[model samples]
Target: MALHWKLVIDTSDAPTLADFWAAALGYEVEDQSTLIDRLLAAGQLDDSVVTEHRGRRTFRGFAAIRHPDDPFDRDTGVGQGRRVLFQDVPEPKTVKNRLHIDVHAGAEGLAALVERLESLGATRIREFDKGPAGHWWVMRDPEGNEFCAAQ
Candidate 1:
């Protein structure tokens, strides 16, 4: 069988990137605090590794989200379906992403989505063209990771 997995994006700020991708793809942010809670109870993660947000204890560096109704274990809240995991990195991003996501818009629409992404701080870098496959626009995230949105 083919291997199935989620693409983990390593970044300096997980929550910020997660929010950007959530709004960019219309995906909901996943809360995996039950796992965090368990770790905390077990003394695995020290208090310094966690932060308080809205009166809730949130781990500082990890956040995730998935499409609504995607399979996720209720006990731990890790996604078992379509997912993107954003994890924290200490150093700044110094180069482009070796692997990037290509968004398929497929002639349905582009202007609105691109405008929204720009408002969310994504930069529209360039447009790509193909004879039969058509076109897409390449963009860089705030951290300089490149992704393309095309139809």
Candidate 2:
């Protein structure tokens, strides 16, 4: 039997978190229209509850993505297996993450990517290199979540 996983995260703003992760991971945002558009057209979904998303009017709510080849709901655009769901919360993040992502980037391109991320509102928390065999960068997302850009 195969297993699927959804990495759920808590955030003050789900859409902003979604955008940051999408750019950080080089993945496109999943279109959530599969279930929404049909419901709207059928008059089953309320207009006030849904709004525009990615150029189309969608339910004002969640977003997600998957590896290009992964299975997804054709109508809703929800990809099975690998996924990260960012849900809204009232409280702000005030502590360290128990788990984080490590981005493996080539040496030549790492610096440029780091700069780009900084420009996009990420902060370089620190740099780490031991002797000559190890190197990587610790960066904080706009919301202060930690991730590594491995070199």
Largest TM-score belongs to which candidate? 1
- Residue lDDT tens for model 2, 1-151: 8778788887766677788888877766677776887888899988887767557654455656566666788877887857888776678888888998887775557788788777777889889987577777899988888888876
lDDT of 1 by residue, 1-151 (tens): 8566888999888888888898888787877678779999999889888875445566788778797877888877777888998888888888878999876663447776677778988999998779577877899877778998876
Instruction: At residue 120, give the lDDT of candidate 2.
Output: 70
**What CA root-mean-square deviation does each model show from the true structure?**
2.2, 2.2
TM-score of 1: 0.85
Give all TM-scores, in the order shown: 0.85, 0.84
Alpha carbon lDDT at 19, candidate 1: 83
lDDT of 2: 0.76
